[model samples]
Target: MYRLVLLVLLALPLAGCFAPRAEDTARNWRPMGANGLALGRLVALSPGVTRATWEAFAGIKGQTVVRLAAEYDPVRAAAGCPPPEAGMVRAARSFLIVDLAVTPQKSVDFIAAKAQAYSADGYFEEYDLDIGVIAALAARARPMPCADLALPGYLR
Candidate 1:
């Protein structure tokens, strides 16, 4: 399995939302536990910096990997995505609680380690994603490196 620097997201198709719901706004994202949710493939290649970013955003004290998986079934994602879209990744639709994070690189390492769960031979389930979206998020995000998170599970 392979890790991606960026992925897709989905919302009300933009355009003013047509008929917005109270829950649609980011203001009302209720907290949900991380238990029993379908775990997505963790592509941890660069855990160090990714964990740093997550810690900063999550306002936590320790290094943390912030997984952003969709509430819907990952299979429901486009049958084949090339560059993935913000609309394709549904953050507002769900929440990704911390799975585990011991050090800075712990997150990316987990992502890379979990590749098999979501990919085969190196192709990702979101491989059908569009390049534009992936490129944009890559440009926008402060991605950590694969090496930072490459330790074996025993190390943790």
Candidate 2:
């Protein structure tokens, strides 16, 4: 019985190795409780003004907001813009509260054309979005980290 107990203890550590690594799991991670809808990966497709308006709309719709930013060193780096900064890195402690919605390709195309015609620096952020769209996206937003929000059992 003692030998059996010792073997069980030894096997317990090995059991962990069979489980997926955190990074591996994160790669496949989808926001929990999003039903069939999913938030697209955030990209730097537009400028700051657009981001601000989108954030305002997102607030009204109660979507999960991840204010993300990055720093870029145009020339040889200085003290503030240190090394290992070849590309964008998440900006220091900045976040914009914003609504997120998926725009239909048709709408996106139309807006792009209009911007080109008018020679606008960029288009209004929420030009293609509405409250209903924001709500839909919000419904699928992953629960904010470390906050309990009456989530579904699976998510909890």
TM-score, predicted candidate 1 vs. hidden true structure: 0.17
Error of 1 at 12 (Å): 40
Pick out the ten consecutive residues of candidate 1 with the lowest summed lDDT: 108-117
**Candidate 1 per-residue lDDT over residues 52-141, each given as its tens digit:** 112212324544434333222223222232333322322111112222322332222122111111222232222212223222222432
Could you tell me how far off, in angstroms, the CA of residue 77 lies in candidate 2 after the best superposition?
26
Q: Write the per-residue lDDT of candidate 2 for residues 1-156, one digit (tens) a residue.
A: 999999998897887745543222322223333352222322122212122222211222332233222211212112223342333232222222232221221011001100100012221121222233223233532211111111122211
The clash count of every prediction, one per candidate, is 34, 5
Which number leads on TM-score? 2
RMSD of each: 21.0, 19.4
Task: For model 2, give the 10-residue run with minimal summed lDDT.
Answer: 109-118
The prediction achieving the highest lDDT against the true structure is 2
Report how far off residue 88 is in candidate 2 (Å): 17
TM-score of each model, paired residue for residue: 0.17, 0.18
Cand. 1 Cα-lDDT: 0.25
